[model samples]
Target chain A: MNKTGKKIFINGNEAIAEAAIIAGCRFYAGYPITPQNQIPEYMSWRMPEAGGVFIQAESELAAINMVFGASLTGTRAMTSSSSPGISLKQEGISYMAGCELPGVIVNMQRGGPGLGNIQGSQADYFQATKGGGHGDYRMPVLAPSTIPEAIEHVMTAFDLADMYRTPVMLLSDGILGQMMEAVEFPVYKSKKKLPEKDWILDGAKNRKPRSVFSLMMQNPTILEKHNYKLAEKYKKMETEVIHETYLAEDAEILVCAYGIMGRICRGAIDMARKEGVKAGLFRPVTVWPFASEVVSKLGKKAKKVLVVELNLGQMVEDIRLAVEDNKKISFFGKPGGAVATKEEIFAKIKELIK
Target chain B: MKAVYTKPISLTETANSYCPGCGHGLVHRLVAEVIDELGVRERTIGIAPVGCAVFAYDYFNFDVTEAPHGRPPAVATAIKRCLPDRIVFTYQGDGDLASIGTNEIIHAANRGENITVIFINNAVYGMTGGQMAPTTLEGMKTTTTTKGRDVKVAGHPLRVSELLSSIEGAVYIERVTVIDPANVIKAKKAIKKAFQNQIDKKGFSFVEVLSPCPINWGLKPLDALKFIKEKMMEYFKLGVIKDSTNSKESK
Candidate 1:
């Protein structure tokens, strides 16, 4: 166990890979894609040393399916890619969701409508939060604002995946994936024992035969029953939604943001506070199963709410749903590789507060 | 006391959904029999592909995972890697393996993934109506290739067993047909040998079963079998294309 708590300069992608290793990830299959290539590179070297398996699959489609296979065998598995690659992974992601397989998927989002840019972008908000894959399934999505949060979120992702028996996506942008920051590695504790493999198809040697399948057979009634089970699991996950509020109490204006955009919004909020505006910021850590109830509580005290995001008003829709028709909610955003800077967000906050 | 020959242990009691005379039912029974004879019914993991065999997970009493379209190779690769001691195999159709999933199968075999692939080459895509598949014969007509697969437009039919056998990583590659009782026996032997090669950890093993899709072929069950034997076998010869059992690498 690396108990020595030493501060090390690391990027968000590296932090996520190291944390995944600490969380007992024994299988990683991924392809090289911009902004998130560091993740696959790190895993390729680290997995071998940890006595884990690493495969550079032919494509994102193959990579994610490989993770699905490894996860089926009771191993902690993961894959990472940018937006286009993530799109390619959607089919496998849906399969993983259907099979209730546990694994981690990292999406270092770049601008996209079709291979948009290599720069930072949050255009995948709708795809990630609303379930990009086919079918009526939702993966728990985590948005990290800082390098440390990226590490912590990934560790939490593995636990949540195992707990719910579902895939979890860590949605970050190119900026977060590329920027370096001082981070302290989490204390590593080896699990006392590996989880029991009774459900896995390791081998039926001494036990009753086991099977892992997602098909409910073309029977509508059986499919409905299966879907009902999935819905029940999702309803239970509502309690796990997380968010953070800064000076939201006694504020007349509230700013809703997440991921890197949320971090920039904080700066805008600080600028507003110096200008005598009673403004606060609310950042959601878990985007899916959106922290609606938390935001609604904060909305009760605020006169108005403003959402700042990289995409053209994606998260704003969620914010609007959170506040309902009780308060006026406005959005400020830029799409296709344009990031919402502090100046732009501050300008929006000024207009909302005035 | 009277002795009875029951269905293979690996197969469930549920009746098969395959059309009467469909080779899938016969091949399934043969595979189940192999699993029973080898005493590996309990230690096997079958990956069912997206096609007519998508419901294969239900037919096999052992552990199974239904892979997405053309992704059975990738699924089987991962399963075998994670559980090397377990018998892992993928059952896929022409569209699943030769078309959408070509890269996955090729790469897995290139890496010498110790898994068996039961490639069902029925000439045309059976699940989604009579569409021309990667293995659809030249000059053969189907919904997608209504003008009879022109060699200039559609190119030649893919000989997967012969193609895979050329790869150094593949240890066993054979093409067989389930047309008659004798050929069915040979096909079963080929399937069992592919599984046995994996058990021996020789390398990647593939057995392409030339099957019949009667409805898609616009023929009766008997006519389809005859077409597979006389017509399809001319393009996809039935024999062992490659076998590493004689290679010094095995020793």
Candidate 2:
């Protein structure tokens, strides 16, 4: 059913699929994996009714490739998977990057290194922001703290992908993917003109046949030139979409986090403020072009910086890089698949303040 | 007199990256000639596989996407479905199609995707330094099979043509070789038929060519040709395996 202009209770995974459909994503191919299967489950039924195509591919590798194929033809395409399956998708993702095809990929992350527990964990933070695949390419990575925000990111991820002509990842963890929340289609579908997808391979028509590929292997000169061009594209993205701040103004202690941890930290900041301690929050909306400027500016008054996350502080390094020697940095984390409660974060804030 | 036989309009003027005596160049020429003859160059998209022929896009002057090893069929399936009015095909090697990507090929064929598949079977992994491929002949020596492929340990070479022909969606299946001029014509004819099937909106069509790699096969160009004629052909027999769209055959 097309749930446009309707509010319904949906999980994070289903929210993402509905957003993709509203965003004009008519093609989806994915193999089922833990914590992210609801996305494929939802799209399998929704896509056909929406006059689109859906394929339950044989493997994650094949699914990503199918997405590549659909995207190559200038169709809005997408795929979703979990940690292990995302690892398998790296090859096809790299190829798609090399070819510069625009598409959306959702990673409802779970614990990893290999078939780790299915519980929600933010363990793939490094893999999502840093290059999960090979090469010097970066995709715009969106992390949503709630099901509604995940829906918003899905709606925009496709536009960002086509805007930059690159893949955009809607990165969430199992917690957000599994939890149910009331979500509304935030924005009405737009009638904006998309950039000329003149490079798509739909039978060159009257124009010269254009080849979309990433193999500059035969000539170092061409390959080097291509890399430089991609670097310039990435540089243009640094100013695109950055972060969100909560009560960041005039605070002595600033906490930096993202996704579920950021949501938890927001609750803790309220608790700490009620206890007469000055605390603020910096949440990075995009992991690649991280909110470095916001962190640097927000940490100007705070005497101490606290970084909270799951899986042994993966995002702390980004925070450290942003604030560098200007403030004392403290860290807290759970190993994997363990959620940090609001009370635990508030206690950490109290100890750091003390 | 100047020659009238210049390169086909579909072939680019750039030099091909294929090594000397590699059968890929002939196959590329055959595909290009077929596209020119069919007057479908404007609407045809070719998928280059991951192997020595990975650089096939440089030679073919058409829209081409480079697929990961053994994944061209699945990629082609999506492209053809999204743009069914356009002509799409995948050119893949033996190790690419028969081994790592075997499942994708089977499923795409089973689904009856309206696309063309050009499979090149040379029995050894050419660019990867003569590795023992899934189609490596029994008792054949390769880098991984230094002692020659022992059937007791290594599995038998795949008869992909015979195997894929059994699938219901595969409308046409043939195996041809390009060791000689006469055989080259036959290979071109098979490729032409495969493309024609897609043009007719028939289901999946496949043609496997017994190509040769002189450098990897440890033979001179002529000897490579002779090897395909004598040794490779004996194991991978050349013929039509299926034609479901033929007037003689029922659905």
Candidate 3:
């Protein structure tokens, strides 16, 4: 709980804004988009009070670039948007990651292949985990099943981003962004000292000016070297993988889910156990790197593994790779902005038994 | 005798990579001299555009970052807002600012962000091998406009300074060229005025410099200067289009 007595009943978007404030994020720029609009709405008023800067940018394109600019000045900056808006931001996001600038990007996902309704979906999993933009790079994608977890992820995102010198994503969906819950935000502090950003463009007061650019296309060798450096960073991120397991030590069936779907799976797993079925939940907290080691270990023992999601089986592919011939994988999804209820999922698990 | 011509301390020894007779070198020098004169090099943060000046940061002796094509103005807005005490400016080309990044430039100017835009309108995308730009003239031919720019096929060349000057948030807007020595001095003066406006917190200030690209235009160095004076200047008028602060002070 926040010792400052700052606990409040709020939605995920509002909680994200309050968490950003506590994490020392001093700049925000974003465009208006559904499900995520509350973030910009909340930040618009709260940021100025906290002596920070906020801009309702003309478009998501400009908003990401503005955050990129603020990040280069060695300040904590962030931007939030839905699926379509995140697509428009890919170019700037790619540029930021290429330049190795630290920033936080919140993608409160809405259903999409193209303008797919304003309902929650996990279709953007591959987009976030695998390079969302044109790049040979990756960023830590943190998915939270609850509002408190979302707040916690936002705080951790900044520290990891600054530590890794890459952008970090707080991946959520409309289901979480729109739901109000009683939440207590813990004051966040970096446990370790980060290297001073001598590369930031804060003007050359006592030293020569620093320049950060992404256009290394002129020389093939330069871009190759840059890619090689990014690979090294990605390797370092493997040590920080995190996941959660609920009664997977001895189970016949295991459920793999992320984001809000993971929370839904908890009850479904309990329902399965009540019906004399030994089922468990393996939820990924860091979607990238994906805690594959745990999934691999658990997959070897399980009789059946069901990957549940709100999208059309995107993360199922990762689970398949993690389990790779050790066990056969099955998928259950309610795509097109539809969510599966606990009883509905439990029935699906019953069908898998026979 | 004191040296009358010395390299600006704000300009680096990095040999400019611009083709011979390109105006970017001259414009970059003028911006550096202005920064030197204003004594803001130490506190100046520059946003580089994606055109030929993509490496504009390499040539300057101050802190600089590259923004995706046409997003420098937005970048400058955030940088300037985050550190109000520092001086921020964006250097962009015609294609980057006028075409792809039109909305960003307009909204930033409309918000009256206290920053400067050094818009280089060379009438073509020089870095991308002389493609027809938004500012490419009606009859000008390029790789994309192979048959010359047909107004019906494409559109009228954009007059960026004239367009931006109409916005209330734009405090100072001027269109100047750096073709000749006399006009080069005028261009420098316009740049200084734009930066000075920021120092005075006079909201958005813009300088649209009609620079020349000889290699791209397939013209000789001197003839390129003539092209700007004769053809480009006709559609794009020069001189100050807006001086909101200057007008207010006079009243």
Top-DockQ structure, candidate number: 3
For candidate 3, the lDDT comes to 0.91
- Regions more than 4 Å wrong, model 1: A1-4, A188-198, B1-6, B248-251
**Tens digits of per-residue lDDT for model 3 on B1-251?**
99998999999999989999999999999999999999999999998899899998889999988899989988998899888889999999999999999999999999999999999999999998999999999989999999899999999999888888889899999999998999999999999999998998888999999999999999999999999999999999999999887653321
Model 2 is docked with a DockQ of 0.78
| lDDT over C-alpha atoms for residue A252 of model 3 | 80
Which candidate number would show the highest TM-score if scored against the true structure? 3
Q: Which is superior by lDDT, 1 or 2?
A: 2
TM-score of 2: 0.94
Question: For residues B1-251, could you state the per-residue lDDT of candidate 1 as single tens digits?
Answer: 77576788789887878877888988889899999988888789998888888888678888888788888888887787777788999999999999999999999988889898999999888878889998999888899899899878888999888878878888889999988889989999999998888788787889999999998988999999889878999999889999886581541
What DockQ results for candidate 3? Answer: 0.88
Please state the error at residue A278 of candidate 2 in Å: 1.3
The true-versus-predicted C-alpha distance at residue B142 of model 2, in Å, is 3.0
As for candidate 1, its clashing pairs are: none
What tens digits encode model 3's per-residue C-alpha lDDT throughout A151-188? Answer: 88898899888989999998899999999998877878
Q: Model 2 chain A: which ten-residue window has the lowest total lDDT?
A: A185-194
Tell me the lDDT of model 3 at A88. 94
Ten contiguous residues minimizing lDDT sum, candidate 2 chain B: B242-251
What digit string (tens of lDDT, one per residue) describes model 1 on residues A161-255? Answer: 88788999999999999999998887755423334545776656666556677777777999899889999999977778878888888778888
